[model samples]
Target: MGEGLDFAVKYPFSSAAKEILKSDGFSNITDEVVELAVNKIIDSLAGKSRKRIYISGAGEKEDLLAYVTARIILGYLRNRYITNKFAVNESKKVHSYLNEESGETVDRVAEELGIKTKVNDGMLLVPLPVFLKFTPRSPHYHLINRCITNGFVQIEKQEKKRMIEEAVRKHLERVPLVKKPPQKIISAAKKIINELPKQEIQATAELEDSHPPCIAELIDAVKKHQNLSHPARFCLAVYLIGIGLSDDKIIRFYSNLPDFSEKITRYQVEHARKRGYSVPSCSTIVSYGLCRANCGIRNPLNWHKGRRK
Candidate 1:
């Protein structure tokens, strides 16, 4: 691999990554590529894909092609749970890699993605609109909560890196549909899908009917296999714990998330429980931009307090 394309291999969602794929004319689809792609999908479901990818110069093409192949297989399968999980997992890997990247490298990656970011007065500034576009899924990055001067948003490097996760997610989400894919691709997808765990959900211990409208909506998202915003996830977990739900059942409910990771979930849940955290007030939830409705209650817990199911 050329040194110029090295960044692309590391940040495979970059334009250079696409150019490399197009320039290389990748069509071999040998057993090695297929197997690697299969494992990529399986690792995603197994909660093993968050670790960043590594590649030697000699192996860059194989590594690059493997990612594309895995994405194509997912597109062909057209499974929402698998697609969203894979994108989130891959974006997380990008977020991990970005933390160690140099300032120049970070700016270059943003430029490649057309994010129009720059440094001024020792602060990294992003165009307000661009920042808002990618940060909708992340509440802390919500524009109204951020510091703005003139028309740009003042963001720390960590927040910039956080934006990349959403950018990468949207980029990967647009994988062109695979039509009439080769039998090799079809077979590989089947194997990948077969290996996916069937949700790993815990025993049913939900109290949804008794939940406030906002909490009820969050529970419904998990049941539908949708991803929650980080704030939303945390709010939901803390509220469940406040309601006297056990660790096991809360973890069980979260298992329905497409990117479910048992260790991480258990750790966060335990940490919150020990802190004796309760659900945020309806006003606080509104500040996080997750208020689902005006239930006329001051707190989520009260909306269902006397209506135990």
Candidate 2:
């Protein structure tokens, strides 16, 4: 719990968040998640805490995505001040201690947020809650944080005692309705399409140029593979994004589909390749069969393995 506990915050504030939240209409789940995320950040930064935060998402997938995004962004802000320039002429003592404890990556994000490191004698620990819609072995549930619902956060011992006492004296305040989960996060994507000016989208894309080349490849692959019109493909794209595959690779794999009965086999192989999955694995073959059955359009190339009798 050393490093993991460190990632949890004394206050879990958002003054140092990297994600910007705005209202836009689109049907993608990710959009609404960004909104809930912003609220959480704002609340945490505003000096608010809940004794028991209950998050009931529509499904485990959405729940995990929202949770992970929140933690990554929150973690970044919390650590930004310690590593980055916080105060002019401040001693480098805190920075050195953090570096010695956590790796540079964690320290860097903290530095960006302007946090100073100090020892806490009595730190509150929170238990992360992640329910599994899929098996615990599944990557999505396994890698994501489950703590949004019933997790305790650390604060100065004195501050914690004061807050607990005040909470007991006064009824725990209910966060505004605005902080509640959206009617539908999927619908928010349409809002993004309607309101986000084309120029701004282009600007964001352009800004991503500095993002790793692998990500660009993954995006390309998704655009290409999306031609198959199978829900499995979209699901696979989501999985690939989780694994950090470049869009270009996704597009390249999609481009390789040929016309014929063997399309499924090829897809099975190609998708596995993109994921760095080995052939014949139970999950890989099962996914391939699902894709093959769903993609009835027939590949144009019609390539098959082995020789005909």
Candidate 3:
């Protein structure tokens, strides 16, 4: 039933995701993450009892697809980690999301199915580029990242075979084979946070509920740069959270920027990395440094620009 809501197959990726990955500046990142993802696929396939797979697409219809995908993937990961095996639980009913009335119809179907739907706020909302035709880039694409984020969806502009494999490689590091030491890991995180510099701590604390400064800085910087170029800010935004800055912080910070565009937000972070800022530094120094980097450069207070436009 949930699969009716989530799984997407051959959902094309957005231009943003594609452009970012193609950048030569991000070459170093591509290989490392790809290696990790490949290993995960190999490990999972080595002992799988079934070859069954599920798929879906995005948009207003994507809401349903996203929901279904989350449930199926969650169930599969749970089985994989708990019993070291893959389990099949496919949904038989399917629906469409092509019209404006999809919302009410979907609500009606849910009531009829007797399926209690949970408002999965914990599920991450991934933004797919508008270019993707017929489907969305939900968790099924990057199973590794989806696994790491704990059933959370990842936003992407492209769907590359290598990238999905790479995402899986990074995902394995988080799973616990036995009794997962939750307390120990928390303590370790606290210790690591404490060991970080004061600026980093402050920046992290401030960005706990919003987009990181590195992202904002990247956008602001890209706007200044005449050349439409590398690392594509979209990729940077995706990568920033992976570095540890909280989403809450990212959103809150973005709220402050004038004329901020998600498109711009996406490209900046990727471009910044290509320019040599590590993820941590991008979140901390570059995000903050951009203000200083742009200091004293005045626009002379464009009082007439609004009227001219």
Best by TM-score: 1
TM-score of each: 0.83, 0.19, 0.18
User: For model 1, what is the error of residue 69's alpha carbon versus the real structure, in angstroms, after optimal superposition?
Assistant: 1.0
Q: TM-score of the candidate numbered 2?
A: 0.19
Model 3 local distance difference test score: 0.31
For residues 1-309, what per-residue lDDT tens digits would candidate 1 score against the true structure?
A: 576567777788777888887887767567798888888777777657534345556466777788889888988988777777788888888887788889888878777777778779888898988887777466566667788998999988887777777888878767788988989999998787566556543436556356777888888778777788888999999988887789998888888887778899999999999998878888999887778788887898887654654
Off by over 4 Å in 2: 1-130, 134-137, 140-194, 197-309
Instruction: Report the lDDT tens digits of candidate 3 across residue range 61-127.
Output: 3332322223223233332321111111111112212122244443343333232222344432322
**What would the per-residue lDDT of candidate 2 be over residues 1-309, giving only the tens digit for each residue?**
223223322212222211211121223347666665444433333223332233432332333344334443433333221111111011122223334443344334343333222333444332232122111222332324332323433333333232222221111121122233344432332333344333111112322332222234333433332112233444444444444445554444444221112356356545656676422222442443333332222321111121122
For candidate 3, give the lDDT of residue 57.
Answer: 29
Worst 10 residues of 1 by lDDT: 199-208
Q: Each prediction's Cα lDDT score?
A: 0.79, 0.32, 0.31
Error of 2 at 174 (Å): 22
